[model samples]
Target: MPGPSPHLPSGPRTLPGEGRTAVVTGASSGIGAATATRLAAEGFDVVLGARRLDRLTTLADSIGARALPLDVTDEASVAAFTGALDRVDVLVNNAGGAFDARPVAEADLDSWARTYEVNVLGTVRLTAALLPALRASGAGDVLFVGSTAGLVSYEGGASYTAAKHGVHTLAETLRLELVGEPVRVIEIAPGMVRTDEFSLNRLGSAEAADAVYRGVREPLVAEDVADCIAWALTRPHHVNVDLLVVRPRAQAAQHKVHRE
Candidate 1:
């Protein structure tokens, strides 16, 4: 064999996310917090953002990251958050949540609007505000934390499903629009994740949220989803993970789950 071919390609000289700045929203709890922690350990200069300044500050100090107040649904908040950032190599849009679980026939229009405001409109606003900074980075990444609800609908989840569907499409459209750019657009969609506040916030009670996972032997936790996100972001610059859907072994589909 020829001793090391001169024409062969070499591996990356530096680790992915090394010496880069990553901004994570909705980072007060759940997947957002877990992702911020993981990314910080991976060598990125992480910035945690959420409306809860107290929680954000605690988490940031623990991980040696910076914490900033951000309310994605508020235009003023988005402007202020983006204005305070000096560099943004990675933008993790993780601020959205499900407010209610009701069927279309009994739909709460207010809840629907709130859902759309945070999941769809908020993501658009922040991404638009940071586009210039991302473009300037030369090797930027935009990652959306979406949901499996975006892929399939379930009973009593019209508002959340619809909003996540919008997120799915937004990621698709942006990727298409930025085809020739150096930016990498990625989306991580998780199924049946059992977090501290997600289910309780949507279902409206501790017991109600517990009932959602009563018999399930194993359901995904926030760290599980965060692991998937870290892996996707650490890939080679040219390798864009368009969409990564991760679910627990107990969950096979949106309508199907293995129970005790």
Candidate 2:
């Protein structure tokens, strides 16, 4: 007996939709917001997730993307964020930030735990909860927004760097595990990005945050990272960009930055 053909007469099946759908975490500001906007411009219906409802709503309104309030640390919030979506072609896990900077010797255990809560556990929870939807989509693309800090540590950034290293490893492992599935996992690691509130959010003080990059010339911007993410997503299915690390020319590495 002849087996049924897996191939179709016309061609291999593609996602049967005009506009693709994407769910972007941390979409209220910075790289998340910029990526959501870019996806919309590329004809994707984006779902914006963040802890800030007002900011999410405002950003969604501007980009015509749906808004969902999500605290990735909370399992319930993670469930609701993925539950509301019928189909999500792309998942951008970007809802992480550095906690207060303190040396390991003086580090508060609670602060260290908080960083892990948001960066490591948050990504894991969200990704697991949405795996079914991603598999269902048949054109699933998962993007993890990592940092150069993961690759190389800096002084006073032990917790943040450690958390990011976990994210980087997760992305790598996922790529291996999902090889049989029709899903692509990628990591976008950025150097110092000049965002409005990144340093402020990381350091817990606006003045202190400003001081870190005050004299640096032409650091990478939020849009730059966003653009890289969009580019990776838009590539043909046969081409899988495994890992991309982007940094400004001024930034050679975490340990080396030119300040003039």
Candidate 3:
């Protein structure tokens, strides 16, 4: 899969955003934080939303963006979140994460449920809430920061993989349904990104997270993925990036990660 663009020609098209509003979920850390900053620099009025208010405030302050407390899994919270926004042109769904790496047979039901709620249900809620505004904007974009896990299954990644697969399909279905509509649905699936908390939260230890990237060549970072998001949104309104799969060279595939 391709990661970043080598060079992109500036098309003679209307930029999706030129003085527009963008809502970024999971802005508390990692890819979310990186994307929030990126969009802001791209001349967007960025709103940062996440459960962690303190972190959100910090990021918002640094980037001159608004921060909102949001829990995408809760319908009420999502309602309040969308209600607060007067206008939204772009919505970046970056709030999901992996809970555990257990096989299907030994899966922890709670972990799986949590994964689905946040990864799939949360995205559905937010996207539904913002659809009306997006359609009205005439150049709206819905971008999902998915994972390489969505494309291929692995031994101990059933739950995450399944949830991402749902996300992948959701993007596909939404795009097909929205044809000729003003809005566009795009999905960015990345592999083997080394963030501060991703591997640590999944594998449960500073040591374990360290080991995941130890002896590997440079892995993709949160900012790298953010770069992709910014680039896609800048394209002409008619150019919809259907699905982009990005993986670090070391991570050839989900099950074929190169450790050394």
Candidate 4:
């Protein structure tokens, strides 16, 4: 069975159209899509950002939110995403992924660069661009979707682990930098989420993807992560959830997994 969803405080949290807005990147699918939907249901005017315009549009339509085409790797695209926004109270930096699995000595530099572009630099660009809006809102809450790979090492995960470590550092630094301000920075490190495209996207092949988690029992789901994010975002203004780590019962560690 899946774990219980995280709990929220017992007060009126930030509400939608309360003159506040939320921007969710990588909103085309998985945790990003689920977070966007969850935020919308909580009455937040959500801005969905992703490379796939059609997917963003569909998500926005379903959630009654706005859509923006965002290629996190592109400076201009990140600029456009932040430029088009106003009074953003929440920012979920969920636009990132690993391209492939390979040893460091044999790794493709191009793939490594691509991963850094989306995972590390992309979060930096978007966060920097929206700092002003976040500062202006006085209730800025930033959430970065990190991974368990960041907290530990694994075979064929050099590039991804490096990028996620950078993300973790960035979040930590931001938390310190924004201490004087109302802005709060947080990181959610998830483990083995069974998103439809995650493994396929990483391996770039159906067979390879299928082999990764073929026998895993009760792997984490997108909604589970989304629920955690929602709970974090809804915390009282004075409370800040610095870091949250969530994994399925079958996943005890990065390499120590119980596969049925």
lDDT of each residue in 1-260, candidate 2, tens digit only: 97668774566544322357899999999999999988888778889999999999999999888999899999888888778888988899998988778898999889899999999999999999888888888889999999988788888999999999999999999999999898999899999898888889878887997788887899988999989998999998667888899999988888788898
> lDDT tens digits, residues 137-227, model 3?
8889999999888888888888899999999999998999899899989899999898999988888999988998998899999999999
Report how far off residue 185 is in candidate 3 (Å).
0.7
For candidate 1, write residues 58-147 as lDDT tens digits: 999999999999999999999999999999999999999999988899999999999999999999999999988998999899999999
Best by the lDDT measure = 1
**What local distance difference test score does each model get?**
0.94, 0.89, 0.91, 0.89
lDDT of 3: 0.91
Score residue 252 of candidate 2 by CA lDDT. 83
In model 3, how many backbone clashes occur?
A: 0
Q: How many residue pairs clash in each candidate?
A: 0, 0, 0, 1
Off by over 4 Å in 3: 1-16
Between candidates 2 and 3, the one scoring higher on TM-score is: 3
Choose 1 or 2, whichever is better by TM-score. Answer: 1
1-260 per-residue lDDT for model 4 (tens digits) = 96655674655776743566989999999999999999898888899999999999988998899998999889888877778876799999999999888999999999999999999998999999998888888888889999987788788999999999899999999998888898989899999998879889889988988787789988889999999999888887788888899999988889888988
Model 1, runs deviating above 4 Å = 1-15
Q: What does the lDDT read for residue 101 in candidate 3?
A: 88
Better of 2 and 3 by lDDT: 3
TM-score for all predictions? 0.94, 0.92, 0.93, 0.92
